[model samples]
Structure formats: structure tokens, C-alpha cells
Target: MIDRVRRFNRTVTQRIGALNDAFLSSDRSLGQARLLWEIGPQGCDVRLLRSRLDLNSGYLSRLLRSLKDDGLVVVEQSGTDGRVRTAHLTDHGLTERAMLDRRSDDAAASILAPLSVRQRTQLITAMIEVERLLVASTVLVTACNPRHPDARSCLRAYFSELSHRFDGGFDPTRSISADEEELTPPAGLLLVASLHSEPVGCGAVKFHDDARAEIKRMWVAPTVRGLGLGRRLLADLEVHAAANRIRTLRLETNRALDEAIGLYRAVGYHEVLAFNDEPYADYWFEKTLDRSTAPAPNLPDREH
Candidate 1:
């Protein structure tokens, strides 16, 4: 499997001119070119560019310097402190980007030109699947305050989704409490899952004591649902619970959400009697973590 992956990488990169000093027939190397693209029309914060590309600060600084020297990009500090830096494309940079776009389209066309119609379709489909999985794996989950803007945004989306799905319609006030204070530290924690710096999902855990931790507000956006984010969030919450000496994890969900029910069961949760009188809950489930190791192996769900 390792050999296959290496072979695939070599072939794809070589064929795509990824190793070329001038990518897409542009003067800039692939890294610089990509940085320019990411800057976009509105520009981007220098700190964000470093993070999104996972580049070291020193290296990113050198790249930005090179672009500035070429007169294609400008880097300036904004705000009263003059500490926050941003990189913007100059007019020359916009013209260069347009050229790169054309070259990229032509390069892509060249790859398909040699292939038969059937082969072209198959290759494109396979590439799409690969891109989707890659994006999914790139998702980052971080613990944050439930009151943060991104966190609240995710919850709003989650509640809106629930209202659309639930037969009687969902109401946050009537639901079991997973309030801001409850999700704060010493009581519990809230996690936000982000893809490309945008929050895509969130999960919360409220610890009652050393023995029990209840998972709450677990949700993923519609666009990112099938990427196994739900399972990832559940596993992360379980890990957090275990770290806090929590032995048993429990959650309550509505019957209308078949996917949620299946996700709970797939991860070794056993259905139980009503643990709490959560108004929207039609089912309750529990799982005891090993504590000695990570969460249990994910059993294949029917949908997947």
C-alpha cells in the first residue's frame, strides 16, 4: 500500500509539473504561485497565509519578500498598532494571475487530450473522489468557547437543520441544557471543527462527575456530512472525556435523525432507557470507554 501511494504521488506530481520551478508556465514557483492565488482579490492576512499553507513563518516571510521585490505583490501593516500584516496583489500581480489561470486550463486540457473519452471520464471521476477525501482529512478540530462567533454560527446552522427535520419543529429553549456556562471549562468543553478556516461542525461535552460525561450539540454542516466528521467529533469528545477521568459517555437524540442514531450505534453505544427528560429525545445511548486506549473501533454504518 505504501509503495502504491508513493508511485501515485510521483506520477501525479511529475505529470502535473509540480516539481517545475515555473509552474503553469509562470515566473513564480508552485509555492509562490499558490500563495498568490490564495491572496485572492481581497488579499489575506500574513498570519493566515502561514497557517493555511502550514508553512514556517521564516519561509513564508521569504516568499512574500520575493513577491514584493518582483513588484507583483505588496505587503503592508494595518491598524493602529501597525502589527497586523496583509498581502495584496498589485495590478501586475492580477495580470500575472490571469496568465497563470489560462496556462493552468491549458495544462489540464493537455492531460485529457491523450486519453480516450471513456478513460477521461473515469480519470476525472476518480480525481474528484480523491479531492473530496483529501479535503475531509484536512479538517481541523479545536476546543473553543461555545460563545465564539464560529461556534454560535455552527449551532445556528445545527438548530436550523433540526427545525427542518423534526416533525414538531425544534426549539432550543425546550431542549436539555448545554448552555454557555455548562460548556465552559471545569464544567465541560466545546470543540469546533473547521475546514479551510470556516467552522463546519461542533461538539460539546458536559461532565457531571468523574464517572459520567454527556455529549451535547454534536453536529456537522450539510456540505461536510458524509466525510466522517460526525464520527471524528464523537471520538474526540470521548477522548476528552477519558482525559477528565470520565468512564461512561451518554447522549440523547431524536428519532427523526436516523443518521445520528446510526452514528451512535456504530460506535459501540448501546441504546438505553431515557437517561434524561430531554424534550426532543426519543432515544438515549451509552458507552463505556476502555480508558486504557482510544475509543472503540468504528463499526461500519449502513449508510457508509
Candidate 2:
């Protein structure tokens, strides 16, 4: 598997001219050119650029410095926040970026033009699958404090989505509570799934004295759905529950949440009688945990 990955990486880099000093025949290296493209027309936050590119601060700074030296880009402190910096392209830089775009299109065309129509279709289809899997692999799921900014963001989005999807519109106060205090350690823990260091999904498990745990706030951003993230979050939550000696895990969901219900059933959960009077719930699920074979609960607390 490792060899296959290495071979794929080598092939992609070579095919895309990633090893060239001047990518797409531009005057900048592949890294610099890609950075320029990421900066785009409206500009972007320096911190965001670093996170999205998975580049260290110093390396990103070096690339920005080179662009600045070439008079192709300008870095400025945000007026709204002195601590926040943004990178923008100069007029010359925009022109160069346009040229690079054309060149890149031509380069891609060169690759596709050599293949027959069927071969081109096959290559494109394979590329799409590869990109999807690569994206899925980058998502990092970790134990996060419910009070953390990312966790809070996910909760807010989750509630907002529920409000929109529910029949009478959802209200947290009227539903079963899974507050900050409840999600903290010893009581329970929240697992946040992040892509590019930004929270995209979250799930929480609340423990009880009787070796039972309840899943709460399980959600994944719409943009990141179909990546198997919901299943991943549920599996991790189950692992945490089992490691803590929990013998049973349960959750309740609204009938409107068909996807969540389907996921529960697909993952060995069984429909059960009302476990609790959750007003929004129309279905309840319970799962028996095999603690003897449960994986250790050593999920990371930072970017993976």
C-alpha cells in the first residue's frame, strides 16, 4: 500500500510538473504558484492560507516574502484586526495569475489530448475517486472540549440545521439537554472532526453511573456529507464509550433525520422503546458495546 501511494505521488508530481522550478513555465516554483492561486482575487487571511495548505508558518512566510519581493503580492495587516494579516495580489500579480491560468489549462489539455476519448473519461473518473479519498483521509477527528471554539461552532451549526429541518423548528431548551457542563470530561466528551483545521462535524457522548452512555449532537456539515464522516464520528464515540466501561450506548433522533436513523441501524444499533422523553425524538436506538474487544480511547486532541 505504501509503495502504491509513493508511486501514485511520483506519477502525479511528474505529470503535473510539480518538480519543475517554474511550474507551468511561470517564473515561480510550484509552491509559490499554487500559493498565488490560493490567494485568489479577493485575497485571503495569512492564517487561513497556512491551515488550508497545511504549511508551517515559517514556510508560508517565505513563500509570501518571495511573492512580495517579485512585486506580485502584498501582505497587509487587517484593518479590522491588527493581529490578522491578509495576502492580496498586485495588479501585475493578477495579470501573471491570469497568464498562469491559461498555461495551466493548456498543460492539462496537453495531457488529455494525448489520450483517446474513452481513456480520457477513465482517467478523469479515476482522478475524481482519488481526490475524494484523499480528502477523506485528511479529515482529523479528535477529542475536544465542548467549550472550544471549534466545538462551539459545530454545535451552533448543528442546532441551526436541526431548526431548519425539524417540523416545528427545533429549540434546544425544549429538547434533551447536552450542555457545556454535560459534555466536559468525567461527564462526557465531544469529538470534533476538522478539515483544514476548521470544524466540520461533531459528536458527543454523555456517561452515566450505570455503565451507559448517550450519544448527542451528532452532525456533519452538508458540504462534507457523503464522505463517511458520520459513521467515523459514531465509531469513535462508541470507542470512547467502551473504553470507559460503558456497556450500552443509546441515542434519540427526529423522524426528519432519516440519514441519522439509517446510520444507526447500519452500525448495529437496534430500534428500541422510548429511553427518554426527548420531545424532538420520534425514534430511539440502542447498541450493546463489546468492551472486551473495544479499541483504546486515545484519540488525539490536536490536528492529526
Candidate 3:
């Protein structure tokens, strides 16, 4: 598998001119060109650029410095927040960026020009699948404090979504609680899934007497729903449960959430009698965990 991946990487890099000292036959390396393009005419936050490009601070700063030296980019403290820095393209930078775009388009055309129509279609279809899987591979799931900003973000979005989807709206106050105290260590744990440093999903499990746990706050952002993030989060939660010696895992959900209900059933949970009076719940599910032999759900490695 590793050999195949290395072969694919080699082919892609060569085909895309990633191995070239001057990408797109330009004077800048691939990293410099990408940073320049990302910092569009309107500019971008330096921090955001780093996050989006997944570059270390020093490396990103070095790229910005190179661009600055060439009189193509400017880095300045944001007027609204002096602590924040923004990267903007100069007139020359914009000209260079436009040239880069033209070159990039031509390069793509050159690659496709050699292929037959059917081959082109197949290649593109394969590219789409590869890109989707690559994005999925970048998702990171790890234990998180419920009160942390990312966890809070997911919870707020989760409630807002529920309010819109549930009949007559929804109220957290009326629903069963999965408060910070309950979700913290010794009681429960929350898992937050992030992609490119932005929280995209979250799930929590409340441990009860080391034998049972209740799943709560299962949610995937609408934009990332089709990426199987919810499943990944649930699998991680299950692993945590098994490690903690939990014998059974259970959850309740509103009928309006058809997808969530389907996920629960597909993952071995079976419908059961109402376990609790969750005001919004219309279905309950439970899954017995076999500590001795149940295999963990297959999941992609968490992004670092």
C-alpha cells in the first residue's frame, strides 16, 4: 500500500510540474506560487493562509518574506486587530498571479490534450474520487473538552440545525442534558472532528458506571455531511467506549433526523423501547459491545 501510494505521488508530482524548480515555468517554486495565489487581490489573513495551506508558521513566514522581497506581496497588521496580520498582493503580484492562472490552465490542457475523450473522462472521474478520499483522509478526530471553542461551535450549529429541522422548533432546555460537567472526564468525553483546523463534526459519550455509555451530540456540519465524518466520529467514540470497558452504547434521536437514525441502524444499533424521556427523541438505539472480540470499525488515520 505504501509503495503504491509513493508511486501515485511520484506520478502526480511529475505530471503537475510539482517537481519543477519553477512551477508553471515561472520564477517561483510551487509553495511560493500557491501562497501568492491564495493571497488574492483582496488579501487574506496570514493565520488563515497557514491553516488552509497546512504550513508551519516559520515556513509560511519564509514564503511570505520571499514574495515580499520580490515586491509582489505585502504583509501588514490588520487595521481592525493589530495582532492579526494580512497578506495582500501588489499590482505586480496581481499581474504575476494572472499569468500563473493562464499558465496553469494551459498546463492542464496540455496534460489532457494527449488523452482520448474516453480516457479524459476516466481520468477526470478518477481524479474526483481521489480528491474526495484525500479530503476524507484529512479529517481529524480526537477527545475535546465540551467547553472548548471548536466543541462549542459544533454544539451551537447542532442546536441551530435541530431548531430548524424539528417540528415546532427545538429547545435545549427541554431536551436531555449533555452539559459540560457531564461530558468532562470521569463522566464522559466529547470527540471533535476537524478539517483544516475548522471543526466539522462532534460526538460525545457519557459513561455510566463503567458498563454503559450514552451517545450524545452526534452531528456533522452540512457542508461535510457526505464525507462520512459522522461515521468516523461514531467509530472513534465506540473505540473510546470499548477502551473504557463500556459494555453497551446507546443513543436517542429525533425522527426528523432520518440520516442520523439510518447511521445508527446501519452500524449495528437496534431499535429499542424508549430509555429516557428526551423531549425531542422519537427513536432509541442500543449496541452491545464485546470487549473481548468486537473489532473496531475501520477508520482513516486522524490528521496531525
Which numbered prediction scores highest in lDDT against the true structure? 2
Poorest 10 consecutive residues by lDDT, candidate 3: 295-304
Among residues 3 or more apart in sequence or in different chains, the pairs in candidate 1 whose N, CA or C atoms overlap within 3 Å are none
Q: Which candidate is the best by TM-score?
A: 2
What lDDT score goes with residue 26 in model 1? 70
Which regions of candidate 3 fall more than 4 Å away from where they truly are?
A: 18-24, 29-31, 50-71, 74-77, 295-304
Q: Write the per-residue lDDT of candidate 2 for residues 1-304, one digit (tens) a residue.
A: 9999999988988887643323537767878998998899999999989988889999999999999999999999988899999999999999988887777777778889989999999999999999988888899999988878999999999999999999889999999899999998889989999997789999999999999999999999998899999999999999988888899999999999999999999999999999899999999999999877787877787531
Ranking of predictions according to TM-score = 2, 3, 1
| Whole-model lDDT values for every prediction | 0.86, 0.90, 0.88
lDDT of 2: 0.90
Model 3: how far residue 161 lies from native, Å: 1.1
lDDT at 53, model 3: 92
lDDT of 1 by residue, 94-177 (tens): 888777777777777888999999999999999999888888989888887877888899989989999999998999999988
Candidate 1: segments with Cα more than 4 A from true spot:
1-6, 18-99, 295-304
In Å, residue 271's CA in model 2 sits off its true spot by 0.7
Q: Is candidate 1 or candidate 2 better by TM-score?
A: 2
Model 1 residue 213 lDDT score: 88
